[model samples]
Every structure is written in C-alpha cells, then in structure tokens.
Target: MINDNVFNGTFQNLSQKNMPFEQVFLNILQFMEKDPTGNFKLMFGTDSQVYSRETKFITGIVIQQERKGVWACFRKVILPRKMENLHERISYETTLTEEVVSLFTEDKKEQLIQIVLPNIYKGASLTIEGHIDIGSGERNKTRIFVKEMISRMNSIGLKAKIKPDSFVASCYANRFTK
Candidate 1:
C-alpha cells in the first residue's frame, strides 16, 4: 500500500521511470482539465499472476479520450508466497483490487466525478470498468467465483469485467506479472 491507508504505489511508462501516485493522479486531473473536447472515460483494474515462490499483482488506471488519445498508469506488488489453489489466488487478486480502490479517498472520487460528469451530458461518455482475470470455461475452475467477484465490486458501486472485456487485467496487467 502507498501508506497505511493511501495507495501511494508508483508506476512506470515507456519513456519514464517510476512515478509516485500523487504525481500520476495529478497528471490525470490535468489531462481532464486540459481536455477541450471533454470526451473521456476513466477505468481501473487489477490483475495477478503466480510463480513458484511469489505472486505478482498489477493495478492500472486508464483514461480514454476518443479521437484524441489514451493514457494509462500502473503499479505492481509481489507477495512472497503463492496461495494454495486457484480459488485462493482469485480471492487474493480481488483483495489487491480492493486495496487499490480504497486508496482513492472520498475526496478524490468526488473530484473525479465532478470533472468527468459534465462530459456525459455534453455527448461524451464515462465508464469505470473493473477487470478481473477469471474466465468461464469448461476447464476454468475460477468460473464458480465470477458471480461473487462481480457482487463484491457491485457492493462498492463499480461494474466488473472479465476475460475478453477485461483487457486491463487479462492483457495489460498480465504483461508486467512476468
């Protein structure tokens, strides 16, 4: 965690080294404020992968402004030990997502809403998509836990995405897990 209660985690970009969360958040706010078109959507998600001795978790913040551009920031953590089973792994991943979300205080959330809401009424769009790594398949044991995961996010008022739709976790975060 960034601090006891804040997720001050740092992230990196192709041309940049690690950046503090405060700066990254500021960058997002500036991006919104400078957006003359006011057409942007913000998304957040977490994903994890396991190795023999540890599990790596990554969380991302994405901003999409159609016909303009898109930008993303991410942070990662490594747990020293792996969980016992797929169920445990999936559960732990959810906990990591919750931790990242909790890092956003009520004030920050209000700030984001205030900046993004007006765009919606102006013919723009806003979406908050939570991407989980679990998928439904004949061999996928994690399928059983999908509903619970979705419900967990719903309790916090965020919609959840999985598999193909959950590229933030399944694709973006998966890249850094290695």
Candidate 2:
C-alpha cells in the first residue's frame, strides 16, 4: 500500500478527491487490466519546490500505456523551512522518489504477488523505473549529483533517470510541486 493519500488528478479519469493509497493502487491495477495488450511502463518519482516558508514535495506514480495515454496519481508533503543547499535538496528529492518506489516494488510486491492476475505481473517480470529530478542540462545546478544519484538507484537494483528522460519527476511530479 502507498503511504500517503493519493490524488488522482487529471489522470486515471478520476476527480480530484483523496483516497487511501491501497484503494488507489488497486484501482490502477484494475484500470491497467482494461487493455491486456497495452505496453505499460510504471514509473515513480518525486520533485520538490522550495518556498520561503516551506518545501513542497510531490511524489508521483505514473502508468504510461504506450499509445493509450497515461494515468498518474500523486501525493504531496510540505515540510516547514526550506533546504538551502542544492545537493541536499536534490538528495532529499531522490530519497523521496526511492521511498515511493520501494513502497510499491518491495512492500506491495510481496503483499500483492499472490494475486493471480492475467497481466505480466502474474508470471512475468515487471520492471519499475525511478525518475529523479536532477538534470544534466547546462542551466541546471543539480547536474553534479546526476552520477551519484543514478548510482544510488542502480545499487538498489532500480533503473534511474534524470531530466529530459525523467518525465515522471521533471514533468508530471513537478507540475504538482506548487
């Protein structure tokens, strides 16, 4: 189960209502089943925006079904006070993404692995990608942590991504960070 309340947002064809993480996750599973032949990529990531009074963190879960469109849900957390350093801030963002991925790939995997579904999840492999907010773009200060962050994720057996390739963090999750 997810740790925070999920906001389906414009994705999932649901209204902007908060729901239990488990229910939201289960709903996603059922939704994916609607198209058995669709190629789905599940990505998890987090992004943060620092304000004078607080830091807003948005963790997003994206299910991209190629050609069929996307379904996403996000959870937000606000911490009092801002992080002054870029490295530390990026680390925090990556950690949050890792945490959310862990909740699904490790925790929920064990809990839901028993469900005999017709999808690849039943007897095939399901790869989870972790998207980081750090980018290698020249104007981006977070580039320095790119290698370190990607290494951290790889060491945990999770494929890492950043910037342009990390739409889950840079685009989807970022949109809700405000």
Top candidate on lDDT is 1
Q: Tens-digit lDDT track for model 2 on 2-73?
A: 333332322222364565567667766775666755566778888899999878878888777677777788
Tell me the TM-score of model 1. 0.85
Cα error, candidate 1, residue 52 (Å): 2.4
Q: Name the lDDT value of residue 107 in candidate 2.
A: 58
Error of 1 at 17 (Å): 3.1
- Cα lDDT tens digits, model 1, 1-178, are 3333223357765555579767777777788777634676666677777788877778777777777877787887777777568777787677777766776788887787777677766765555667788887768778999999988877766778888687878887788777
Error of 2 at 127 (Å): 3.5
C-alpha TM-score for every candidate? 0.85, 0.79
List lDDT for all candidates, in order.
Answer: 0.74, 0.71
Where does candidate 2 have its weakest 10-residue lDDT segment?
4-13
Alpha-carbon error at 120 in model 2, in Å? 6.8
